[model samples]
Target: PGRGRRAGSRRVYGTLEDLLGGDIFSDFFRTFFGDFERAAGRRPGRRAEQELEVTLADAYTGAVKPYDIIGPDGRAHRVEVRIPPGVRDGDVVRVTVPGLGDLSFRAKVRPDPQFERKGDDLYVEVPVKLTTCILGGEVEVPTSTGKLILKIPPGTQNGQVFRLRGQGMPRPENPSQRGDLYARVRVVLPTRLTDRQRALFEELARLETAETYAGAR
Candidate 1:
């Protein structure tokens, strides 16, 4: 019933006691236990380490979609924006680059504007869900400057909102119900960085003697 060796016997030494007493078996067990001990000492997993499932089903009208940012895993990420009054394709939405994060450039998704005007009312279909390339990436943008950059830190959140000042246009008739551009920061870790880049980062970390921006409670 056994393939050359029995459960209670040792194939190499012919007996359990003989195998246990051998130098090779003793060395093997010592090495195995040592590695296991080191592995068991690591920190446990937390909610932040979990993977999130996101979906986008319905198509958006009058929304802008810039070039998708590819994560380290080679996947494109899209951010949804409401088609504010008078927004069209190729219009760059100024976004502030978040500290420790990168900025997202959202371009118009639809080729033609999709808004209906009825008497004194105007309506447009907006995106139900917006995606960000980096998670927890909060942007500080200046719309008037016509220069925006998004800097997403290492840990951004999904569905977190960001606003652009004066970027929204006045409603067609009301002039008060103006629409604003919003973005959600998506977090993604790099699959891997090159050795040279890693070394540079390690060096930069070593040079930091003081805490620069650890938020104060």
Candidate 2:
């Protein structure tokens, strides 16, 4: 009877791995869980937000809310995603959700003008027609022998443009013609950085100043 009890107890008291089911979904396997949130909180002399959420969406894309991550302290946080710009009907977008994962989906951008900000924090409204083709898809170029792929980098800016000759909209009077594609670029900086990293950066600045002083002579 004692032997049977021992076996039952062993089975009941499984390892932490067993409780979590698998390594892929386990805490150890995650790249960044609350790292960003925690870092944000620590820097500003406050706790990382216990309850936080960000929502991104559009009328056509509907609502997409990724899985919420629970901190060790039992706080729930979720990230909300808005529909991507420039995707017409049947177009696909690669959505990245930290901690939870990434996914792709099909959606469309409304024909109405959309307003968004640039890296400099300037806001601008862009017409749908000018941005329709470049959203979520790469522009392809044809050479004499084969083809070339041109990818537009993320965080594109306003008024900046990419010129792909003969890639523009077809003219009504010219059936054999097409228009070029122009894409803008946007750059973003994280709101904060680690203390160690900031110290290193400051050291670099000092070094650069020393070099400049030496060159002046």
Candidate 3:
């Protein structure tokens, strides 16, 4: 009975020594402590992620906006974020905070009413009067930058698209370069016609429907 008791004690001591001397005990404790630290929210220097809402113009022009963040100590602080030009939706911007963890900003660009942006290109619709379409005059068109004077050719048809070179949103890769702007022409007809205008139109219609017009054509 004494030898049996001694053998059991040796086996227990050997098992403990093997556990302590090898990396098994240290690794288990390290993993347990790491999990506990994470669960208890005591991890140091953890990064934070947030979303930032920006306007299309702001994204296009590149702006410095204020960002409010709550630190681990529960104090609110304001930070200035530099939004690069041509930043698109879902793009990430990183900023390092002193003592706090790094902050990541995901850009969310709002839609613009004046322009429809698609892959750096801008599209807009311009309304042109019937007389201007027929007489071929200059019409003011709205672009991403500003108003532009677009020449309307004589007998410009409705739904005609005109391409304005280098007048679009800035390219994300190269802000100095830009894309094109497509302006679709929408002709606006006269709502009410004057008596003299009706009379002249009646005469023109009579001339147009005549058999001689067909023969001439």
Best by TM-score: 3
Error of 1 at 24 (Å): 82
TM-scores across all candidates?
A: 0.24, 0.24, 0.71
Model 2 scores a C-alpha lDDT of 0.37
Write down the lDDT of every candidate, Cα atoms only.
Answer: 0.34, 0.37, 0.70
Q: Candidate 3, TM-score vs. the true structure?
A: 0.71
What tens digits encode model 1's per-residue C-alpha lDDT throughout 1-217? 1224322221211233333334323322332334333433445431111111111101121333222222333333432333333433333444332221233232322322443322222233322212233232334433311335555444334434455333344443454554454434333445578999789779968886546334422
Worst 10 residues of 1 by lDDT: 48-57
lDDT tens digits by residue: candidate 3, 55-171: 788888888876544454545456677889888887888877896556577777878887888888889999999889878999999976679999999877788899999888788
Model 1, runs deviating above 4 Å: 1-162, 166-177, 184-189
Model 2 per-residue lDDT tens digits across residues 1-217: 2223112122111233343342323332232354655544557854222211211123222344343344444444443444332223444445565544553333433233322312111122222222333343454433212344655444334344555555333332342554443434332334576999789778968777564445332
Candidate 3 Cα misplacement greater than 4 A, ranges: 1-48, 207-217
How far out, in Å, is residue 114 in model 3? 1.6
- In TM-score terms, candidate 1 sits at 0.24
- Give the C-alpha miss distance for residue 12 in model 1, angstroms: 76
lDDT of 3 at 110: 78
